[model samples]
Target chain A: MSAPEASVAVRQRRGSFGRLFVSELQLVFGRRRNQVGLVVLLGLVTMLGVALKVSQLRHPGARGGDIISAVAGNGIFLGFAGLTIEIALFLPLAVSVLAGDAIAGEANLGTLRYLLTSPVSRVRLLAVKACALGVGSLVGALVVALGGVLVGTALFGAGPLITLSGSRIGIGDGLLRLLLAVLYVTVGLAALGMIGLFVSTLTEQPIAATVATAMVSTLLWILDAVPQLDWLHPWLLVDRWSAFIDLLRDPIFTDRMVTGLWVDLAYGVVFFGAAWLRFRNKNITS
Target chain B: MTATRGAAGRRTLWLVAAGALAAAGITGLMARGAVADPTLPPLTPAELLAKVAAADVDGMSATFEQRSDLGLPTLPTSSLPDGEDLSSAIALLTGNHTVRVWVAAPDKAKVALVDGSTESAAIRNGNEVWLWSSEKQQAKHATLDPSAKPTPTATPMSPSEAITKFLDEIEPTTEVTTSGSGYVAGRAVYQLVLTPKDDASLVAQVRVSVDAQTFVPLGARVIADDGTDAISVAATSVDFTRPSDDVFAFAPPPGVEVTEMTKDSAPSGTEKPKGDAKEPTVHGTGWTAVAISPASTEKPDKELTTILESLPEVSGSWGHGRLLSTALVTAVVTDDGRVAIGAVTPERIYAALAER
Candidate 1:
């Protein structure tokens, strides 16, 4: 196609980006791996809730600051507990799967060329993929949180939330805080997705990209544990993922949470930029 | 096609540059403090000390952070059950703590020690005091003697209270000077530097910062002889506005276990005084003073014995013992069942242990 003709074609199909994003979502959710991953998450949450309930029945009155003990008192805590647990491993894995597949899966199947030949610009295609990845992370977080709420409230009725400040807050306010926690976690996972996207652009093998992305994330966590690396903790992407717990405080301490958001933004911008830089000018022989 | 490819490459490069800039900006912003060094009229150290003593405020609310890097190994608190007083107290010695304080003049106050998902609060309303712990889901209530009366010297719990205690120990062995002025919790503060004349003292200097106008202390830093901040406590944010009356009032939250106790029945000190151990004896004066106390008659627990054994053993004219030396303190456990501790060098501890 002539350059001028291609410009006209891109302008004409600009409105179809939303359709492209929807199709991308369909592709992500339609895959068997992602479907099973989500189902396993729900199953794990249910088992966790059941175990907490049983332990409470056995011990009767156990109390402490840890999440497991907190779960015995309020059902809402189950949501927090589930999210904390999944964020460590499962949710990141789910995000890595979709983001790692964003470009490489298409190329591996020899469909990237067909998609690029259409009226869509390479940059536009990446934007759509990023949006799809964002939605995928959100869904992964929501499954854990919603499942926790459903199972938790069912097992132990919801009422006033006892705050970290040892004060009582109404259920409405507690739910709002829980929602904020989910959103915060989604931001961290989306940042991880961006890293996966950058790694996805580096290779044509989807499995290799997924494994590398997951390893990069796990390595950040490991480095965070080493005392000598304290200087680098603030820069690590996974360092503040647990800052969501701050929302449960009486007046909510926003310092760490604010820093967490900034870190996520920085990672998202840089890694997404890297992915675009690598992918936009690549040969589409596959 | 080449032209389009070239344009795409340029756009991607620009995007990468923008991303890199954003990352650097965030890092720089995190490292930068909002307030710069504050300017204030000069005041001699003696005059500043007097100002701090006379200064008083009716009401205020603040969030403060305290970090004590004592070089002591942190005992794992998570595995221990909640309300294990010893573990919790030890945990406080080696980590960062954030506390929110609300005070209204002489009669009422509340302090909440907030951890990530748990809170422990002490609220004082009139003659009543309530201790609440969220993690343990427990609350303790006690009533103080109403006739005890509030003394004019009674200050609310703040950095000011702590600074006064440190200032009271000043003597000829200490040299005081005004270093400079800076900001604490966005308030202009005059810094008073206290240096110990005794070279044997582990503390090199103690810096106390007080609000320029009110003279209320906003922060304090204890610098070890090695020049490390052994204990740093500062107010991150503060407001002088009167806190709401309801803050001091405490009602046990739903689902928590509440215990009632008379003033006499309430727990006082953290450690019980052993029947065989005599009163602790103090030796020397001012900065290098050491307190020698009788060791507990009961045998040390397996864990404690192991920890004690891990310390380096020392022998001198003062006799043989295990030495525990931190940046700000040196401790000697003598074979004769005496424990001497002080913020002084091992030589001072030895002298104290050898003294009749």
Candidate 2:
């Protein structure tokens, strides 16, 4: 009876969830570094678009016997590869920049104490921050993908989206591919988000959290690429994330894809579970 | 015991996780196991060929459409005008039909590419003898029999040699299915969709129309990864009569610029358009001809203004993509290795005039 009443009382005290999310959004995107990542992402996608345009113009003969051209003319090859090349091995880094710094940046600014001093429970704060970060990541991924597609279509013509694999997918299929790529990449980066969030909780400076997350994620990727250590392939975070290519194949293969998504989700769970356990009972005087 | 327990716990968690992921994936494949493993009873090479050879061939004509992801060919796709050789051959076998292949010789022939598609290819390799046009360049040579295996000199791996190779993969991926039925090229064609059991493959489905009685596949549609229908090739005309051996041979006419494909040829089109070639290129009119389409839209979209301005000074030839695709289709369909402009449409004539 006492537990129920305490829970009801705590829930009532936090005010509306809407007000909380609004504040969280402001805190996440309302920073200079987020703007920097955004600018970098835009510039990168723009470069990819320009490159595709110039290459097509410069080398017409180079197209024959080229599978990319055949598929592109029939309207299938542009969007999938263009997006992947523009920002893979690079996505996790951007994610780390924003998420890795979330909590640590707050703690460093000495504003963390304000939250602890308020009636906010540790779990509520972690939940709100994660949700906000997820939204931000979603926005970032969509912007890059949309920018790539828009530019690719404008310059290359809105042909069908061809795959590296030997299949010619149409235009509608291209949009679906774009959505899948964005969603999977965003989910694949969730572990980084949690790692960044956790590191943020421990450190005062956001840069430390950001760097730590990028270092760990990238190191795991490098480890995954080492073929000799065959046994370690499945365990590392990067191993599971490699399924991003599956989305581009002609007939969608969901078996490996779904499995990868779940593994990513598991990583997020473990990270959040650890964060919850660590910060739930800790004191914050900073 | 306590240390052992901790290790065991970790091991169990790992085991369970791995097992769960694998099982989930396999289960999905099993649940969505709509594609039949058609090759349940695989046939040997000889049986597949005899079945195809004796199939009926007459005035059956189809608007054969062959699409390659790249202008170049890959895998079994390397040999067929599109991805039909396998399905057509399979239909010939179990569906009760036969299709004949008349291999072309490289020498004693003068063939040229009539169309100008950047990536797709169409080559008149041997006069009316043997025609070679590929979406891509793959090494293709001919073999004496289906089971004889391709030798380095006569491998049928190139797009021109696709007709033979297409029949080869068919016996492996096909099963006698009593599914959809249809007619193609004036032959009683039975449409059997071959379901390749490899779940990871991009070929989601293949819809082939085989002569219902003859079992010769007259038409087929190759669906790509994006669920878009990429290629639709149909047999426009099939002549079962044996052609002269000289059909495959090619010899350039007198005073012709026979560029002995140098060790270092300038890079072709970047999916290259023929008009933009850095080196001297081939022109279409010299070899054989009639405007197949006369309609320009079927051809490559080159900057004619640039070519026109450079006219008399331009190094290479010009053609359209549609013409390339058509020349390729005609070569495969007629099998005489000799495809001249059989028919001409008015739209194509206008397009041709503009290009000229």
Candidate 3:
């Protein structure tokens, strides 16, 4: 083929790949279950805001940097408080639903064969699905945070952010911290998403993949809580889930936050690597 | 083809061997970081107790480090006296802190908290006690009654006081034994371990380290039933030589706010009673002791009540109220306006209340 024709063919392939990623994102978010999950997450954030407001009204003098304490009188801290609450279970569950359904759901529906018949490589398909899950996780996190800020601001009214170290910061800096908190939570959940993606590749049944992913996440949380298992604490994936609290400190403690990010990155790399290796070699019988 | 395959297999084997070596090396370094147990003569429980009871040291200065993981809610700083540095008190309740203490028996002592870049010191010189906060540029003065005994209460501000208090409160209900010997602050010490006889007590063991030479307690550790250290205080460095008299003397620096506490006035915000509240009374004895106090008439503000309500509720012969239980401590607030708290279980607290 001539140079121009070869270049044109390469450009066409690139354009199609871009379209595939966008369509994958839309398909992931377009599902009824994922939509319901997003709504449920928002509902949880609202309920938390209401509970915190009621507690604040009852005890005006309570102190701490916990979710309830942060949202008591300062609505701007709602994003941080919401992130803390959701990162425990809701965020992981949401990410798992999308990632667990990524490949397995396609196979279960008998569409995997058709998708593979296209010019797309298995690696490219997996990458697109992973990217779709990543986008979904970030959106889920932001929805919860935005819901919390709206509900908390309406009820408590906006005020200066009071850090865990008992220092007051301006609204602009508080919002910036809130953004960083949302980003941190999103990245943390994406690590869980990677695990779900790996599990999804193991089974043709979407439900089994979803359940396995959630069970693994819950097991990590349980390991983190068992005080006697001090050795397991450092290696647990969710061990530093609450380290985001350090961000609310005046100087912003980054030791645990940095450690948590590294742990998440490690998990993401290993799980994603496993998923790629498995899918690359597996016979697409489904 | 076979030769190429053999070469690939050998490379993989080498990779695994290198990885295993790295893992073992990391584990070895972690193990090496742990404190090494030292060899010493063993003593009977009775002999160790007698030595500790008879132990007394005068005119010693030391830098003490304390770490507490009580899991208690952080108390509001606004509730404390203005410019009163209660970081030590907060540290005792929650995290870790370091302070330098100098005690010259008969009420001459000083405790300086080593905060970053600045320090706060509480000095007791004869009948006058001064608290100076360098960061806040504030000072508080209190005059002690000449006839009043020079108890540790005069300067009950250091973490060492907490350790000393624990050592002094050893009860007959504890099964005392010498666990082993170890080095602390570069001094050879004997570890006298005490286990609670009461099964209801949350404390699994309390370990006290006594100096082999001076018999003074160089360190104390409170281990919860869950095998986590709830509280640990140790002297990182010690000097038996007498602290200079100037160490205990203090004068307000220029441009500092000075507050004088009189006999009729409360010294700290925490000391002030809400209204008509009597001092808490101690009940029972030993490991299962409970402090029964009258519930405050002025209820905790809305926020605090919510926090209290969030705690699990327990009902029994003692009546229903909220119960806050941690690995090391349990606090029960009875419905009938009484609060019982100790290192014992709710059932033990209920039984003690029934006796009362």
Residue pairs whose backbone atoms clash in candidate 1:
none
Q: Which candidate is the best by TM-score?
A: 1
**Least accurate 10 contiguous residues by lDDT in model 1 chain B:** B268-277
- At residue B167, what lDDT does model 3 achieve? 50
* DockQ of predictions, in order shown: 0.60, 0.06, 0.03
The parts of candidate 3 lying over 4 Å away from their true place are: A1-14, A54-65, B1-356
| Candidate 2 per-residue C-alpha lDDT over A1-286 given as tens digits, one digit per residue, 9 for 90 to 100 | 5999989876776564556668878866788878777777766766766765577678754555332344234323444444455434566777877775567776777787786665665667878878877887777777777766676666666764444323346778778877887788778777668777777667677788788888888788788767455346556666656465566533343444566676666667667655665676567767
Fnat of each prediction, in sequence: 0.68, 0.12, 0.00
Q: Looking only at chain A, give the TM-score of model 2 against the true structure.
A: 0.86
Interface RMSD of each: 2.2, 12.2, 10.4
Q: Per-residue lDDT of B93-186 in model 3, one digit per residue for the tens?
A: 6666667788887689888765332356777898898887654556789998888754656655444455445555665577767877887787
Per-residue accuracy of model 1 over A1-286 as CA lDDT, tens digit each: 9999999777778757767887888988999989999998888888999999998888886656676677777788889899988888888988888877999888888998888876677888988998889888888888998899889999987888777766678888988898999999999999999999999988889999999988988899999878656668879999889989888876677777888999999999999898888887788889
Which residue pairs collide in model 3, if any?
A58-B302, A58-B303, A59-B301, A59-B302, A59-B303
Please list the C-alpha lDDT of all candidates, in the order they appear. 0.83, 0.51, 0.75
- In model 2, the fraction of reference contacts reproduced equals 0.12
The candidates score, on chain A by TM-score, as follows 0.94, 0.86, 0.94
Global Cα lDDT for candidate 1: 0.83
How many collisions per candidate?
Answer: 0, 95, 5
